[model samples]
Target chain A: MSDEPVRRQVTLANPNGLHLSPISALVKEAMNHEAELLISFDGNIANAKSTMELMLLGATCGAVLSVEATGVDAEVAAEAAVRLLSEP
Target chain B: MQVRSGIPVSPGVVVGPTLVLGSENFRIPRKFVSRDVVESEMVRFHNALDKVCQDIEDHEILVGEQLGSQYAAIFSAHLQMARDPRMVGQVEDAIRNQSNSPEYAVSRTLRKFAEQMQNLGNQYLAERALDIFDLEKRLLRELLGESREELSNLTEPVVILAHDLTPGETAMLNTDYVLGFATEVGGHTSHTAILAGALEIPAVVGLGRCLAGVSGGETVILDGDHGQVVIDPDEATMERFRTSQARNIRVSERLATLETLESETLDGQRVQIFGNIEFPQEVEQCVKRGADGVGLYRTEFLYLGGNKEPTESDHYEAYKQVLSTCGDRPVVIRTLDIGADKVPARIRDRFAESQNPMLGLRSIRLSLQSTPLFKVQLRAILRAAVHGNVRIMFPLVSSLLEFRQAKMILMDVMEDLEDENIEFARDIPIGMMVEVPSAVMLIEEFAREVDFFSIGTNDLIQYTLACDRSDPSVANLYRSGDPSILRMIQAVLKAGEQYGKPVTVCGQMSSDPRFVPLLLGLGLRQISATPHSIPRLKEVVRNISIPEAERIATHACSLDLARDVEHYLLGELGRLCPDLVV
Candidate 1:
């Protein structure tokens, strides 16, 4: 169980912006891994597990967000969140 | 604890637990929990969240089944937002650290987030604040154990206390469980008021923020007769209301018995009691109340609500529905009378603005000027006339020229229909509303041209007194009991008699029980009012003799002051029917 955090930056690709559907998808994907995941958008940090926290970030289309995770699944979770955010 | 008065739109008395329906901007009270009870407050918060989530999920599934997946997906978003961990954590933090109650914590946290979203200045993001507010209200309602939706799942009969009920909400009400309703907003002509009257429930509207003082399950005394609501009444007030309620029930029972009887005076002179309805659905109520026919079916409602102009077929369908429902009963359909403050922006923008719209282009004037619009309505009326006994009435005909011009348009439509070989009633009785003082002064000329005359006392009184009824500052001066208005009514009745044409009073005055004897005495053989008041009006009509009513009318006309006329009529009404409560 590594305490070191894995970090990745990804740009939101959805044309309609990060509304409830995209936020729900990201939260569901992050919850699949056993890691403490955090997403920061425009200097505002939010827990990736919280749909409302992701929504509060108000990350619009093409906005960049940094995904970070700390635990055994840190690498996988960070990669998954980044991939989901970068997906069409 | 306090008494509030408003305009009574429907008449009855009821006492029951108040069911306060949640509305937009409905506020939840903030309270603090003890420090030791912080954990319990957090538990309550989660429990409420779980309940709201389950409710949303159930609704989503129901919508998915009934509608398609695309429509149902909207509720899925709501569900995800409900279970959002960060929002739940924020609420829980408030409950634990600040010792805030679960409802207050949830409300405060959601409001903060919603404000943040709204302040983002993006239109899409700002709109999301509405979703947060909706969730907050739903959660708070679940925590408070009140139903989140209006007029749904009411287990017991109760008086509904609301800020206001939209026409759609008022339409879906289960009248069996909704004993009565009171709102903080609306007037006598609002959709809520008209619906309440049609449903035959006790309702008082325009209480103005008194609803905020009331909570669910509190006992309330709603006097729909006097338009009063007493919250948490004391022993004395409760006893008086109880007596009044019992007496009202007895009086209603007696009135119900008169529904099957003829509206005749003691001398056996029969009178025609008709109903004035705004919607085609009200035709059933008119028939149920045993109205001889519909004296005034205001068709302006066809133009009011919808986004687009009503097609000729739309008007035809409405008229057909009323005519079919009435069976052999005569249904007098009044043409579109939209103008003044009643004109919507869609129609108003098409015309030049009038500074004094009340005296400007409206009713028959607007109809004549807009030939295409008038012809479409005339064609619809003529087409619907084939279904049953349909009568056409033109409104606000100030002069004989306007009446003749309007009649000419009707003739043109009739010729067009004949050319098309569309079957229609050739001799459908045409009438004119004697509303303007000019029309009243020239009643003999109007009587000669029209098939019948229906005195529209509402506008006649307003025009006669030069007091706008909608203007609250001078509404009290818009009295039907004013001798000048009564004399105008008298003059119309004499014209109808001389021409051997039927004369009807289709106005608020005819519905008022206090004014019924005076109207009967003035020799108005036909009277039309809201369907709810028909039975009560019939009860008054059946009890009085024409000679006695005539004597009262003569004396009332002799009285100089409006107050004196009202006082004398009220006294006579009491003497005529001691048990009747007006």
Candidate 2:
């Protein structure tokens, strides 16, 4: 329910960082929330909903990513992104 | 006289002369040839391979036209591999180098190629040896009479002895003339055993190298029950076997007759007898053996065997066949019970390695996480439920949270289907297998949530005692008749009683006639086992009174020790039916 853009920094812990399946799961959850979500790693940002784009980011394990969402569900989007990154 | 023993795949004893169909021994070429002559030989070899491929194509067409497309496709695939350009090139080079014949050339070349491929370190290509060798051998056999060595013409019902038989050869076997089969080098789950089971032929596989010396035309008796193949029996031994064979036949026939017979005790106590199957082929066998319904249909075989995920239609067709075959009989399909051991390395590559896969992310864990694959199976099952009686069950659920989470997903899938107006079974009884010790301990909670419970005794016994049944050294530790396991079963049954839901035992113990009396004594009304074991179990059930079983149950429960429980049950079994033991 936040109008302002919410940003959260999280480190990828999965040995295989945001592999296709987990990335897909995160993308699916992001789509569920009414938020314009973007994930940035090493100055590279990608649409959280685009599987192909997220894969192209090449974010390996132990890399830090700052995820930002701006919309009615920005809080929910940031919460989901933080939660997904913490899982193996 | 020689006797060989192996696990009996099917029931029936065969008394006949042996027939050995040995592979033609290949000899290395010793002669030298000029380059021109070698080149000519290579051309001739390639032509011979072409002819063989053509023959297989023709045979495949005929087979596809006669039998189903599936059988024809197997032959077609073999033909394609035989014509592989790489293999053709290899054979040609070998022949050009003065290989004795096309057979010798292909065998030698393929062996070298396979070793090279293995050394290249590509697992996928390396495993193609069987595929390549099998195809080339079939072609070589067409070129020379030696390839037909495995197929022998028999006029009498003689026990066919062999080292191994391919599925095609086994399928081509004259069932009427072939009484039984014994092999030296096939596993219990080998293609030969599966084909034999499909054909309802009594077979013993994995007999090792001893069966080679079993001469053709020597009088031999195959004891499928004990996996024993007896030769040159004395008059008394022959008489005893004849009696045993007749009894086995009668017992099977009697069980079949009881297909329409009620699963009721002499005291008029009603019971349920179900069958456990892993494939759709076993559904018809269940009907033939008089199974009231399917207790646990392992759906893993659907997802297994293919590289990619099985389409919804694949799952639907398979589930539909099973449901339609069962008709009104309730079929409880257990969602994929696959573990790290069964899954291919590629699919397993995605998962984090666990120290113990048996207790790791398997069964419910795998399905819950793999939504794409799980949804496909769920949708298929739900869609197939339109045909007949079908229910869903989850496996390896150690906690109520897992069970509830699975049920929620099922509900969501059903709701989506309802929104789409897809015809599916509503009010399908959902259940969980109480195999894990934790689940068994907390059965009361599971019983309240699920409509039914089926105890998978195989896992319960193994996990409870920390023993791997397959390891012969620790097989003693995997006793199902152990008091601890019995206590677990008793707990499950009591929980089911408290919740007023039907509980059944659907593991190996259910089929063992030795343990039947003990289980029956434990107040279990529903029993699901392998279809073949139905009649023996039914006979045991029909003979015992509820009071007698209850008394045995009391004595069994009083057993503080494990082996003592087995002893007590074995004694009871010996007294009740001495013949079943041997």
Candidate 3:
């Protein structure tokens, strides 16, 4: 298991932007991972698994966000975060 | 009777008993707990969260059954928030360390999240703050052992009035019991407004502090047609509402007959009535309303809402949607025309902030500056042209040189597509929006180069008078019926005549029934307007002969004052279509 966190950059693709539906779905996906995940966007950082915090990021459609995860499953968590956020 | 005005997002008339939802913020009872009770308070907080989650799940099922799964997604969001681990941790921590009551901790934690969301500076994200507050309210109700006044439980017919509605609450509003709704605070773009429209529930929003004066069970008249809500109306207003309701039904019944008919004059001259739409979804409405085709599909929506600059495929998909819907009908796809300030921050960061964004690097200027971005849209439009009749129209092209530059990029994109052997429609007729004064003045030069001309009367009126369109003080001067606007359209029309190309008035001027006569009188054979205005324009179009329209135009053009020009045209329209029900 790696001590250092893995990171991936993802941009929001939903036309309605980071409204509740996407935030809720993203939070649910992030919670699925065993790794500790964090999402950073426009100087705002939030626990990726926290629906409230992720929503607080206020990422609109096309916002480039940095996703970080740490644990043995950090790489897998980062991949999942990227896939969820970047899908059009 | 108190007359309240708001931005109408849905269309209907309803008179019903008002069900005003007062503030959900109840008294917390107490703020703190004894240190010895902290462990018990944490347990109570978790229990309330569990109960709130159950309430949310119940709503998910009810909303899913009533309003479809798309709207039910709101509850799913709420459910996730209720079960949020960090949020739960925060509430539990407040109880364990701070010795706060479960109710106090829940209120404090959720309010902090809600306030943070509201101040996020993004409109969509800000609206989601209501969902947090909704969750807080639900949890509070559970913790307090209080009954909730859920709209899904309504039995009698009533109009739901509220301070503000969460998307989840708005979604579950049973149309069977909920005749219509209004709110003290909400914009036309708010989820309440959007859901109201989706539910076909007549709604008025952003009525300010008017709700505090009225009580529940008061007789309310919500006229979404006029964006008005009348409480305790006078006899005259009541009579008028009854007549207006009858008139609304009559007007639609009258307009419904013209759906399949061509917009032809009494003299048998065919005028093309096209739809000007922002979204691809609106294309169906335009088609359903018998628009000859899409005259102006504003492509800025693709760039404006999203964080990323739309890919070629993004543009291609949007164009394909519009073109596929239009089928063989000519669909003139207007390329990106929004200003930089309106785009996402990433794009906005690229442009130097200007005092006046309207006159700044926007439309063709922004496109020319970023040929890569411009080429992506052009390539997509060309590729989508293969789907159906597609014409690429450049917006706000102020100069022949600017128009040439845009054309060169389009030509370049075409060459690239050809080199790559990507299938694309080559014979796409390229046009420029004849909005800018310089473009109108150089119509003769532009006529020699471009395929068609669309007189963007909104910008033309604004630019011709140098009156900011958004400025209320100058709004009176920003008339589409201005003599200068008519003269410019005439010049463009004359040029179109010489060039043997179609010149359409695709601005707000074309959609207006009063100006329809003047525009037709000025020899515009095509009118592209929003779908809602199509049937009325078509009624006016079919009623008058080209000779009559020409006479009206000549009289209107002769008038010095815009008011006189508009008044004369309105009078003529009334005479032409005496039964102008639409």
Best by TM-score: 1
lDDT per residue, candidate 3, B1-582, as tens digits?
A: 789977676767999877767585244455577999887777888888888788889989999999999998878887888888888998888888888788768876876777777777887776777777678778878887854345666768888778787655676678898899888876554445655754667888777756544535557899876679998788898898899789877887988889999889999999889988876888888889988999988776676444577888888888898888888999998887756324445587767768777789887888889888888888898888999998889999988888888888888888999999999998989998988999989899999999999988767887898976434344456677778777888999999999898899876567668888888877888889868778888999888898888888888889998888877877887788765522
Better of 1 and 2 by lDDT: 1
Task: Name the TM-score of candidate 1.
Answer: 0.68
lDDT for B521 (candidate 3): 79
**TM-score on alpha carbons, each prediction:** 0.68, 0.61, 0.60
Displacement of the residue A77 alpha carbon in candidate 3, Å: 69
CA lDDT of each prediction against the hidden true structure: 0.83, 0.73, 0.80
- Model 3: docking quality category: medium
Q: Regarding lDDT, does 1 or 3 come out ahead?
A: 1
**TM-score, chain B only, every model?**
0.77, 0.69, 0.68
Best by lDDT: 1
Best by DockQ: 3
Residue clash pairs of candidate 1: B1-B231
Candidate 2 chain B worst ten-residue window by lDDT = B24-33
Residues A46-69 of candidate 1: C-alpha lDDT, one tens digit per residue: 898886777778888999889899
Pairs in clash, predicted candidate 3: A61-B307, A62-B307, A62-B308, B521-B549
Which digits, one per residue and each the tens of the lDDT, describe model 1 over residues B250-308?
88787888888888888998999999998799999899889999999988778766788
DockQ winner between 1 and 2, please give it.
Answer: 1
